[model samples]
Target chain A: MSNTATDSSETTARHNEKMKRIKAARDKMMAGKTEEKGLIIVHTGTGKGKSSSGFGMIMRCIAWGMPCAVVQFIKGTWETGEKRLLQAHFAGECRFFVSGEGFTWETQDRDRDVAAARNGWEIAKQQILDPRIRFVLLDEINIALRYDYLDIDEVVDFLLTQKPPMTHVCLTGRNARPELIEAADLVTEMSLLKHPFRDGVKAQKGVEF
Target chain B: MSNTATDSSETTARHNEKMKRIKAARDKMMAGKTEEKGLIIVHTGTGKGKSSSGFGMIMRCIAWGMPCAVVQFIKGTWETGEKRLLQAHFAGECRFFVSGEGFTWETQDRDRDVAAARNGWEIAKQQILDPRIRFVLLDEINIALRYDYLDIDEVVDFLLTQKPPMTHVCLTGRNARPELIEAADLVTEMSLLKHPFRDGVKAQKGVEF
Candidate 1:
């Protein structure tokens, strides 16, 4: 029994050494390869900075001379200053698309919301698949998907099928689909610990936007 | 001019309100979005947690049921127990690709080093663009990009074009590309305030993955 135990211990040591050598070799081969890629998703109960998080990424991509597509669902009628700045400064470099119709309950038109969502989804779908467009920000996509304006299964399927290496995609909104979380590479839940709105403070510009 | 000033002040106030409203809406939406979506970039000049920090995020992603891809660039031809554990346990759910080519000058093969680098890049690209991929950890990607083994423009372009509204990408490497630094929505530079490595202690497994 002692001999057998010693034999097993020796075998384990040898096995460990072999594994180390193999890893070293693999690391070498990996270094030989070139290319790096990925995406970002920011959704959580929040004090702030959900869409801003997505937009900040957009600006960063642009500074690197990369093209980006922004698709804002929900707040379609309201004019966001970001849309204006991106258009004027980034002209031809950055593209922004809105739902054209306001929001779900506000409009009280499910058909319009569905139609508007489809419009944004089409743009996002194309950008997600494109190898040339690196940073695709699906601004406020959760509400649309939540309201059943867009099919979750179809969206998830497309995300699963995307190709090319190094493409970065970002989805910012509340109520992200469960399947999306399951399928994501990294997930961050921004649970809102507290907010001023709860204190009856009205929304303010610049600071809030 | 007075009239214009009044209009400007009113517009700014309105802008603040718009920001607040949007933030509130996002918070409300987040209540139902339980799945976490976000990327964690672990970077520091001097610290034991560079890789550890990244691996922590990886562990979190796995717990959430999201698949992960890890590419280690600098630590070539080294035996790491963490790498083995991830490969053995996570196996199908995770991929641990190491560059075996050793350090840049240690091997004295620039051409081969470049080729190995390119290989890592290829793997990274596939992982990053895979929408189903929840997280892609570019371990030491900053080093690769800094060394010019990986093309900066190509990396940025890929980040921009990858599927949007999905995919979370994490870049963990020192001396991150200035452009990449600018492009990151959330950039955290890990400063090496103090480390065992500085005092001549060898790297330990589990502590430095």
Candidate 2:
């Protein structure tokens, strides 16, 4: 028992020493990261949580009393949990625009899709430029871009140049345009290692929405 | 002029037909997904937004009027935007716990780290088993598990067997144990494609925190 205790003690000391070194390195690294600027953030890939993340950031923004806007390019009239929250709870605080009534299901009009995309883009442009809004989430605008409904160069140019210095814009969807990715300050690809839908499990409430 | 109109009409018709076929396939596929169960969700990768995604999910849970709990296992006592939000806005609605005071810099006590992990685990157990708490987030618990501060099998067994049927648990961090991933119903790997930190931009407030 005494030997076992001694052995554990020695292990603890080694672990402590190792941890100290890591902490030192991390602190030094953190010290160098001193500059801050508005970031063009992108969340993309064939996985869940792309839009969920953008929605989450809005909560962070709300927590900080920062004015944020969400422009839903695809899930237009779909009763999303976030939409309900924004409507019922944060109506005055956050600006929300549901531009697309939804794709293909409601109408197979490509022109209509294009028009909705443009409408969403218009709102996004205003929010991105508006210094009042610190953060703007362009939810699923990438899908519209993917289908060639919006001009990639125009959107990228506007986001890169016209966006206010401290205002951040997050675009979430799959197949984010290469131009946007190249222009973004931060890009996260949420890839699906596994999804319940693949195993025939239906989407659940408050989780999928 | 007549030829141009005819060509445009034909293009629109083709697009409509294509969209219809795609929608039909999706509806058929969705029809097979009929079962629902509380999910074991894992957000793990070498990227940002793992915790951000978890934070976002909490907002969704709150929006749905569900009482959720967030047990922060790593960022103990650190001021996070979510923690502030929970305290300031959703105090009663969400239970927030920060377990780790942080690693190494504060204290070089391995035993203390282990104890903190256990302490956090104790809270996690109660929250996971509590039916009132519909959702629980084990933020950065994977790091504790990675350091062997908590037994993986023990943690996994408790999460799998002891968790309430309808309650959901989310584990977030880098390098999640394969056992947890294997058991997870939904796993999204948030990979870093680009980060401003690489360009020497500091972690900004509201966005990072």
Candidate 3:
């Protein structure tokens, strides 16, 4: 037999042994996990896909024929492609509440921003309590919390106490509070590696919006 | 006048002034960016939403009536919720090529894995060059690259040289190569903050799969 063939066979055998060990470990690890409940998922940090991932979850929910609600806290200035598409496809099934005036810098007045956040939170809270809404997306609620427009304590308290047991809530934005993170069942922090905006590229119509 | 009324008026005036300044800055910034081209986006890291975010981009492309393709490289062990959902909605518009045998540990054969990766890459390259495919997702391709099942140099070269100018390509997985990162237009690392698996929660039906 050739030396190359012998070496290849040896490697294959070793790899097979390693895989056996891995499968055993993974099976043991997975066997311990049997619980299922509604998740408080937070997508935060300085990355591009916080809102995008939240929308993906909504799509998954929609595919399962679950009624979903989206409460936009700081993205009401311009119309989004998602809003237009979801409205066209899921008119009665999906309820969208765009309560924010605009971004904080765009709005300029902290008072108005506060009022908008409060209004958005009211809708979000109502959605959370509604058993009909299987998933509630508090879109960009982290920004409102970061700016202190909405009280973190109250938000955390509601998440802990008032939400229906079967409704999943997703909060998306940068700089998610530690308190919210503590309360979340799953938290993903999107780390910015490279962005096209830094390279003088404008956001395209369907890509960004 | 009452204190509340005076404060409200001052706040509105200040907000309007701030919005004007913001519009000027944003307009000026946007004016400088006039170039448009296809983007090579990478979603990597140890988080859970890497593939979910790529699917979000696919959703965006679908909204624009663009034809898209999904070539899953390492997630073919079981039926995924996304595959079922997207296939049902996008019927003839989207093409899904699930070329993976399974995870490495499950397959336990290096030679088979390499062959699967090669087959998947051929389809990926062909789809990437197709004008009809506006968006192509190489889902979990990074895992194939990391394991050396697929040649990173060949993948990087194809991405750099052969991609259609207006066709966006999204690569999703953990541990994306530095070369791929350098070639990508946008790269976002999904940082793992907290996962339900660690808290004795198995992957749920509609949420994880």
- Index of the highest-DockQ prediction: 2
Q: What is the interface RMSD of each candidate, in Å?
A: 18.2, 1.6, 2.3
lDDT of 3: 0.86
> lDDT of each prediction vs. the true structure?
0.60, 0.87, 0.86
Model 3 pairs whose backbones collide: none
* Per-residue accuracy of model 2 over A50-95 as CA lDDT, tens digit each: 9888887888888788999999999997887789888887887799
DockQ of 1: 0.03
> Which residues of candidate 2, in runs, are more than 4 Å off?
A1-3, A104-106, B1-8, B103-106
Q: List model 2 lDDT by residue over B101-158, tens digit each.
A: 7753556788898899899999999888887998999999999999888999999898
Point out where model 3 deviates above 4 Å.
Answer: A1-3, B1-24
lDDT per residue (tens digit) for residues B25-70 in model 3: 9878888887777899999999978887887777777777888899
| Candidate 1 structure quality by residue, lDDT tens digits, A151-184 | 9888878777763445666665667788776665
- Model 3 preserves the real interface contacts to a fraction of 0.62
Displacement of the residue A65 alpha carbon in candidate 2, Å: 2.2
| i-RMS of candidate 1 | 18.2
Q: Fraction of true inter-chain Cα contacts (below 8 Å) kept per model?
A: 0.00, 0.70, 0.62
